[model samples]
Target chain A: MTDPLPTGATIGILGGGQLGRMLSVAAARLGLRTHIYEPGANPPAADVAHAVTTADYTDTDALRAFAQSVDLVTYEFENIPTAALDTVEAIVPIHPNRRALGTSQDRLTEKTFLQELGLTVAPFADVTDAAALEAAIAQIGTPAILKTRRFGYDGKGQARLTSPDDAASALDSLAGAPAVLEGFVSFTAEISVIAARNPQGDIACYDPGENVHRDGILHTTTVPANIPARLRTDAVLLAARILNALDYVGVMGVELFVTPQGLIVNEIAPRVHNSGHWTQNGCTVDQFEQHIRAIAGWPLGDGSRHTDITMENLIGDDMDRVPDLAKDPKCALHLYGKADTKPGRKMGHVNRVTG
Target chain B: MTDPLPTGATIGILGGGQLGRMLSVAAARLGLRTHIYEPGANPPAADVAHAVTTADYTDTDALRAFAQSVDLVTYEFENIPTAALDTVEAIVPIHPNRRALGTSQDRLTEKTFLQELGLTVAPFADVTDAAALEAAIAQIGTPAILKTRRFGYDGKGQARLTSPDDAASALDSLAGAPAVLEGFVSFTAEISVIAARNPQGDIACYDPGENVHRDGILHTTTVPANIPARLRTDAVLLAARILNALDYVGVMGVELFVTPQGLIVNEIAPRVHNSGHWTQNGCTVDQFEQHIRAIAGWPLGDGSRHTDITMENLIGDDMDRVPDLAKDPKCALHLYGKADTKPGRKMGHVNRVTG
Candidate 1:
């Protein structure tokens, strides 16, 4: 087993989005440095990261050099190419392990994994072709969603099946890609539990936060989610069950649907989750730092929060409100320092705390 | 007056120590960037700053180039040379203006300024020479301190006199430097008020934090200082009075001694101070961000503390306890990432929060 990373050790991060930017800040707080490997120029994480290697993921030499420089590797996104992971894994260890990444990278695998653990998930079936799609639709029924098995995010690469007749259109929307047909489950709220586990099998979960989406993008996440305390406990326990099952070694975002019958697992992110951003202002140790602590082999911090918070994302043109928002005494801004604000782009987030 | 700096603006910081390192993070938090200029190699701020210029302060060309690249100039330390300030000021405005900086740069001047502002301060006299030192010693009386007029910090450049007979040795310890003799005031505690002001004259003051020194250096600072609530108001008022009087455009640390005869102003810092570190864990917006807001023309944040915090400096060997401290859930580590730990060198600090 690897020893806890010492102060000044550099951790290699595979993406340079806002998540990686925040993780860089958290690592800096712990006296550990980070080298961000991203293909884009002037990534949001570059301003705060210790080093940046702007090379495409397919560059084997660049990936090898990046891996050689850092003590270990962890990624902000789960869709990394398997060959790229193989290249870096040959040189250094990658936390949240490849198995966790593999499970989360594909919707079908994620649902099957949860079902195998005796957890409730929307009934889902795999479809590799037209015939297979029709058979899967027959089993999962109408009002289902056809989603790409891999490489999907932010409600992308998915189509809705309103009835048996819409099934053909939904399958065509997938464009011949491997797909998962998830049957509709009526739900009242979508809550996420940001959970973490260390290499030694210790698990910690932040309180569940209810999320509100706008235009298929997360708009806000409110802590102490509007759910019965019992379900809150259920959400946390379910998240822990998944973490332990995967033997996860970093923070994971477990998104669940709160239905009248029971909580149903929707999806999981094998990295610091957007819904957990409120912890930055509400908790003693935030999720980014928790992930850092876990992957560095340090003890997972007590995931206890001291304040109630509502975190709102400043997507695209929402940056205009920053002038007025900066004046809000209760707001703590965490802008991503993105140079431009394209539509649906996550520019920043603000956590408003209440006493 | 300059407009509030826009998103993506770059701030130039002088003295790339832990304070500057933190300011960089805060600027990044606000969607701004920072360029750190320091004479040292691989300064602690280098890892997080967007840019670093390693050049001597007297390297006027480099200084001018650094200033021209940034929207405004701010500093981590107050002992900046007048020539250096002039160079930067000629290109970009410097915050916490020269008046405030000049007043706090010298011990004699600082004490005189405080007294002139109708604030309580220790009885003091200036000594330009050894003969003058003896004369000043007689006026201030025995059991006083002989401190250099300029460039003293962390309890350096000072000698204490227990009695009149020790005057010659105390003066000798200063080696004929211009000095100040101040009669000691026995106080129940030492406290600091971290206050901020923007160009528009708006002011905000954090709650007073009691300080303890060990081996002449700040050891710990506890918020909601162990003092009467009335005195806490007095501390905040005194800090605001000073900031207003100077028209200070950034955060200033006001250290005061709580004596029976009200509070005596010990000294002032024209930049963020170590004693205010607890705000990182206790307040909605920390001192670093507040300072950045002030200098950038943004409104000052609400300096309300939601949690009580105790901030302790990790000096040299104190870093040995970091592993155990990291395991303590309430402790928020802020290591400076210094390469080597020398005796008395501040490697970092930890802020412990309480419910």
Candidate 2:
């Protein structure tokens, strides 16, 4: 039997954004310290973390020091470069491992890996060059999406190929980066399963929440998702398969498309995710705290929701409406202390609990 | 109209413990920075706050620097010395006001102030020395309690006078310190109103929660307290009266005894109280976050409980049962991250939501 990990361990997090900010808060509640590493001045997470390293990811010295200071390494986003991970891994354990990062960092690799694991994903083909783009588009057909295999998030670095005329411009839009063409699926809704896996192989998942998006930004997520019980079970099982296959430890968010046929994997986030924010108010264990427990090699927490809940994102200037939102007895508002409300930025969110 | 407070502003917290830890979390969610000013080593709040000052409260230079670094000052505890408040107040605004602190610090002053405000409190008298103790005991009678005038919490610095002989011991036990003799009020139950007062004089009270104490330490708090509508109204009015009297900003916990005659004030916490921990998983706005917002001069939050909730304290070695407690699907656990759990030490607490 493993000796229980004490509470004072430091958790090193890469990507000091809002996700890291929330994660640090969750870690603090469990008596854990968080050291945030980001390559910028005044990232959001810097405000709440115990220690912060404001240096480029390529700063090996800083990375090494951060790794040495922390007991374990986790991340808030999936775009962490291989070199950065390599440096940290040399000194400390990085949960979900480098393979999980490698697989999640690239769209093509993630799809192929999921397919190999017997999970149905959007039909896709790798596009290495102009010829590959044309061939993939021809097979995947019109109205498909052509996206760079790496470094894409919140709809950036991706383009829709609605027609043959849109194909070249779509490929050009990626600026010659390696891409993938994915055939569209007619789905009723999008859902996600936020689950955490411990090193001991224990898995716990918060109920899948149905999500709605506006302009590619998350709008709202409702738990006890309006789906058949079988479909919900399948979504959770698919997440378990992904975690087991990766030997994953830490929280993973598997976004899926709920179609008439069944559930299909859309993407995987090897960290606390936006869709899982509802868990902050809905579940017994929030995704951020769940990730901390997983990486610290502690026992998994209960991941059950005590009530049906809906989480609504307060994007950009929407935070200005907090005063009005406060009037509703059911709303729990969270506003990110971003310096400016730039267009399309996620400022905060509100959780409304329901019976 | 006042211009909106800028996001990313620094908030100075006066105590560094679990309350400040949760406050920091809430502030971060609103995109605000928190700097904790504490006079202790390795405080829990320091683990997550953006900045920390490990200096004595009366250290003027350190207090000046801390005051200058944040937009406003609020505390996690109410026993803060007047000199410390004066030091911070000279440089920055202190929430809940110095008048509130001065009145609440001394039992005699608090009782007199409440009576002057036309609020109901148990009969009490000052006990300065043996002569005064004898006089107070004669008037208040046996079975009264003698407590120090200042600096006491969690049932410390108090002695019960069951008889005239006990009065002398209680008075002598205080070592001739200034004290007060309070006549115990016969009541049915204990409840507290957790509420916030913004700079604009807006007061929002969460529904009262019934409290049960074990060994004078709060053990459980149940929301939507079992009380008549009129009693709940009276409880809220009494709390609002105190906040208005103090011209207080930030959240305050007002403890009361429900007597057959009516309600009587027991005590008041000028900071986030343990009884309000149920809001972490029950209410739309948690008391800590509400306190931060009020102190930061932001608008108060919606104070409502959408679900019935119960909070249970994790005392002493009871923390060893974290795993079992975390396994309960109905429970949400909050650990303080304290290094040791001695007898009567508040290690953590858990909130169980019952819809």
| Residues A160-239, model 2: lDDT tens digits | 97787888789889999999999988899999999899988999998999999999878999998999999888888889
Residues A85-199 of candidate 1 have per-residue lDDT tens digits of 9999999999989999999999998999999999999999988888887898889888888999999999999999888898778878888889988899899999999999999
Best-matching candidate per lDDT: 1
TM-score of 2: 0.95
Model 1 lDDT per residue over B1-355, tens place:
8789988899999999999999999999999999999999988888888899999989999999999999999999999999999999999889989999999998888888898899989999988877887788778887899899998999899999998888788878888888999898999999999999999999999999999999999999998899999999999998999999998999999999999888999999999999999999998899999999999999889899999999999999999999999999889999988889999999999999865
**Which CAPRI tier for candidate 2?**
medium
Candidates' C-alpha lDDT = 0.93, 0.86
Can you give the lDDT of residue B253 in candidate 2? Answer: 93
Residue A94 of candidate 1: its Cα lDDT? 97
Clashing pairs in 1: none
Evaluated at residue B327, the lDDT of candidate 1 is 90
